[model samples]
Target: MKKLIWLVFACMLALPGYSQESATRGTANNVRQPNVIVVPYAKEGQDVRQLIENNPLVSRAVSKVKEEFGNRGFTTKDFVTLLKASKRNDIISATTGAKSDPVKDVVLESKADISVEVKIFVNKHANGSSEVSLELQAAEAISGESFANASYTSDKFITQDSLKLAERALGKVNDDFFTQLQNGFNEMMEKGRNLNVRIELGPNSGIDPYTEMKTGNDLETELQDWLSNNSYGGNYDINSSDMVIDISMKVPIYDQVSGKPYNVTKVRGPLISFLKGLLTSEEHEPKTKASSGQQIWIVIQ
Candidate 1:
């Protein structure tokens, strides 16, 4: 008995899935899925603690980000961790959900820095010679790291006066940042991932598996269906680029009297049902609450 138990334990340790697992980041509860983080950018060593306490735009953006991301499998604590860990300049390096460091073949930067510039002339004296051009810029209460080291400048003038100009610039930057962030996330979707597939036919027994046909002029619809079914990732004309496999099959039996092989007979059991219903059993009927052994019926007079 002890020897059998030892054998079972050894089998578990030797199995690849049981012993080794792929690494994924950002998942809390030690579960499967990716995580998201939001960071802010503020002036270097700028006194903005009181500003956060008072500002509304900053608070609104933070709240929306939390609400939106949390609904997409993110937690406040996870977002905070991501905010703390993620670099302000690297919003596109997101690794959350089913993939880890899933960003392959491309790089993304989701951070936006709204920089507004106010250019104005100040006259210290009535004389025309006493003129000075001043440029001032500011960012509102932002906690995300994307704001840090942001490379942006505005040529639009907020106003002619220095104080008013600076204020206008700040407003423009905040508005631009918010708009950019919203648009960036709204259009976000994962790219079509690739899955390798191959079909090999065993020697046909009763089904003969001998008849074959070739497809000519494969069009857009054909290519799309093939790619979708086979999990192909590349995009091109089916007629020009990726095409389906052309098969040739020979008839199995020969006519005894004619001394020639017989024409192929095709089976019509919906092979092109084509490995369907993989994602769900929607094509299949759901289980009904029927008793296996008995049936009840009422008779009316």
Candidate 2:
């Protein structure tokens, strides 16, 4: 009478049982995940000095950033409210600019990111000389202001710049003002494109030899052969450095009538723990149990 054969196999690795972990859950190697930093300008008020400051340009720039982030992630807005609360004149420029543009040529300068503000002045330089000077007032002292009209419109960057220049305003470039906005927006978009993450599958599990379970180089050779034959792509990477494999066994069953022999039982167990190191695609460790269930014996032709 031919004996029945039984086999078992499992692909799980054994891990040291520990209590539940807290929010900071990770292996020892995990120091910090990836992160990104973006700065956006939030609106404050719609006054004149505050007017251009809260202008559509600033608002639109910030809006573009949020749209770019989409579902991928979230951003922390660290606006430099310093401008809103502090002195209105040059002091705001000097302290925040890291003294880069000491002359205060920049109306809005961003560093790591501290503040967002807009400048409103009748430049005797851009507009080519204006008969009336409005001084540096944030309020609308005069109606139909050319500079004010130029800045908020779609073509405002150029229109406002021309009006400002016409008034002989030096160091103040209205066209350039919005240009920085464009630059900042571009920078935000560039960063969004660079963020990425990738993952790969490592080694597989297999059976082991008895007494002295198959280990070291001997196991690797056997594993490579099986993987190449069975895998579709016939491509894998095994970590040979300090490689350790899990071992198991297999039993064959044969039919007495046809005199044909084949595998029936494949018992596998003794999960593994990846405590030592990483596993690669080429690396495969033999399983511990492959033929040790109900019927471990069967006719082998």
Candidate 3:
């Protein structure tokens, strides 16, 4: 038994331990069905505190996340390999110094649904057991908005190597993390998909910004009504100058009628249809902005 205990200690020293932290979100629906990408990381100047991305501990932790989320129907993408090939690996070199330009650019270019930024740390105990911890944040690829965050420690009281320790740690809080992710996604849906809208009136367009519609409502009022009826919490921003109207809002990402996910073109489908009918001149279809999820620019001809 002495030899066995010594062996466990040796194993613990050779492998970094992992831990789990509490989650900060709740549950929701149809919001977390996005492709997942896990990015391993360490702190800016605290690289010694945690293993680097290439470390076995980091890789194992990434695997654990993939496995857990995968079992729940989320498709996992190998973002680390891509980052290496593109020399963007440095983007996640450390947690603090994460270079947004390359990392965000790569993320947007890949068109991934979500990015899981992960940092892991381990502490060895004198009692033949080790503690492994994980810090994770889930963000939308397009807007880089974090939807959920959690810190967790392993449930297994006695663990040896970093791989086993990390796996067991993640297992302990896997369900809670999943719930947090779903809740965040649902919240984003409730707040509306982030979008940029532009409405330009043609030189010959008959309707004036201040003119009243046949419904006894002015152009602004009609537009407002159309937007409110179709958006989350009826939220949006509008600015006008000359014949141009620019509106920015969080548009719904799911169809209330069909209960289906909304792509960029479909995000404002109802609103566009309504405006087209109201404005006889012409209205161009909504165009999605680059690196912006569901962000659209619309023009009135």
TM agreement with the true structure for every prediction: 0.21, 0.19, 0.52
The total of clashing pairs for model 1 equals: 12
What is the per-residue lDDT of model 2 for residues 214-281, given as tens digits with 9 covering 90 to 100? 33444356545554543222433444333233322222122223322222221211112221122232
The model with the greatest TM-score is: 3
Q: Candidate order by lDDT, highest to lowest?
A: 3, 1, 2
Per-model C-alpha lDDT, please? Answer: 0.28, 0.27, 0.64
Pitting candidate 2 against candidate 3, the one with the higher lDDT is 3
Backbone clashes per model, in order?
12, 51, 17
The positional error of residue 16 in candidate 1, measured at the CA in angstroms, is: 9.2
lDDT of 3 by residue, 180-281 (tens): 887787677546556776666656566556666557777777888777765556788877777877777665555555544445565456666776666534
Worst ten in a row by lDDT for model 1: 292-301
Please provide, for model 1 over 197-227, each residue's C-alpha lDDT reduced to its tens digit, 9 standing for 90 to 100: 2222222211111222133222234424554
Indicate whether candidate 1 or candidate 3 has the larger lDDT.
3
TM-score of 1: 0.21
Question: Among these predicted structures, which one has the highest lDDT?
Answer: 3
lDDT of 3 at 208: 57
Question: What lDDT does candidate 3 reach at residue 39?
Answer: 67
Ranking, TM-score, top scorer first: 3, 1, 2
lDDT of 3: 0.64
